[model samples]
Target: MPPRPPVPRLAGDGKGEGTVLQVRRLRGGDAGAYQALRLAGLRLHPDAFGSSWEEEADRPLATTAEALEANYVAGCERDGALIGIAGLRRATSVKTRHRGVIWGIYVDPAARGLGVGERLIAAVIEQARGQVEDLLLTVSAHNATAISLYRRFGFEDYGLDHRSLKIGDGYVDELLMKLDLRPA
Candidate 1:
């Protein structure tokens, strides 16, 4: 198949005022930009992600493309540049199909505080709705900004994952959060 054409940026919700931001499910063709952004996130904020830059920096583009093919990743683009991303993957097992996990959420520091993160999460939630009963995510305990964003979207802290990640002999605890998408 011919390479998937680039998706045009969607008009931003008036919230950004003059900033033109768009969120869409990334395609295999987006692997390069996605990989660059992922590595940047891992390198710039090692504590926020479980994967280290060293572990993924050398991974091939095919691996990233295949991964994107297997999951739902929403990329937030501004002026045609990928600035933020979040992924949602539904459980594949028969018994766990009702669940979806959100991961790899990141926004370029230059784009922070412009609602790019919010748009990314909203895109993930919108995509996951109806397909999964619950949307779950884990965030570093010290990331108050992310916690607040999750809370605003109705995700509540369910428990703590002690020592979830170990980086250079230092352990990081994570807050397990869940958002129930099913109606009561």
Candidate 2:
């Protein structure tokens, strides 16, 4: 398969403030930045993520880079820094190859409300359009912002996993959502 083309700068109401939000799939070389942002997300919002800081904080950059090479990762760059990221991966098993899951979606606090998250998701959907018939994700039942964003993109709740993630002494419920990309 040919390499996917880079994502163009998604339009926003920046006017002339220089808040251009460009979305693109992160490559192997971006592993360091991706790791940093990912760890930050896990730290700042422990309940929002399934992975704990202790588990991934010590992961080597090489391991993260290799993961980037293996998955479809969409990143949002403001100016020159990677402030947001979302990743998608198609199932490898023959019974589930038609499914793709979006994971580790995060945006910096400073970049929120500027459409960065939406653009990241849009890029992922565009990438998944013809490659997979269904896109799936699990979001913490309490993360309203993320849930709303996914709903705007046509994802529908199909089930719920009670106590999906056990963080410290509490459990975080996860809402399973899926978007059907196949047409009638």
Candidate 3:
């Protein structure tokens, strides 16, 4: 693949008055920032994330860097602080090569409703467009905000995976959503 394009910085809420979120491709040096934001998300919204902080904490820095390099990792930074992140991983199976999975989507509580998640998702979708026929993602059924956001981007629910995650003593259902990029 060609060198990933530099993340574009756009005007956000001027300084602290609002929120100025810059969405761009993540790099090797961003492993710590990514890890921090990711762990925060997993802690705050356990059902929204597939991986736990415990699973990621012991991971090698090289592994994190490799993920940033191999996958389409986008981050939303405000005032030089990383507050949000999303990633798109291309399917490796031969039959699923035309699809990409959207994962690790998280925005800090303080950054919600400031368009940071929207920008991050938009960047990921734009990056996935040419490389895959469709983008697939799983979201907690109870996450209305994210569901609305994905719907606004033309993603539609195809099915539900009931009892997909065993959280604590109960199970949670996940909604499977897909955004088709093929010509109509």
State TM-scores per candidate: 0.90, 0.90, 0.88
Per-residue error (Å), model 3, residue 131: 0.7
lDDT for each residue of candidate 3 in 54-157, tens digit (9 for 90 to 100): 78778888888888887779998988999889999998899989999999999989877678877988899889988998899999999998998888788889
Tens digits of per-residue lDDT for model 1 on 1-184? 2232222243344586668788899999999999999999999999999899999999999999999988899999988999999999899999999999999999999888778888898899889988998899999999999998888788889999999999999999999998888855
Better of 1 and 3 by lDDT: 1
lDDT, candidate 1, equals: 0.89
* Full-model lDDT, candidate 3: 0.84
Candidate 1 global Cα RMSD: 7.8
Q: Clashes in each model (backbone N, CA, C under 3 Å)?
A: 0, 0, 1
Model 3 alpha-carbon drift over 4 Å, by segment: 1-18
Ranking of predictions according to lDDT: 1, 2, 3
Candidates' C-alpha lDDT: 0.89, 0.87, 0.84
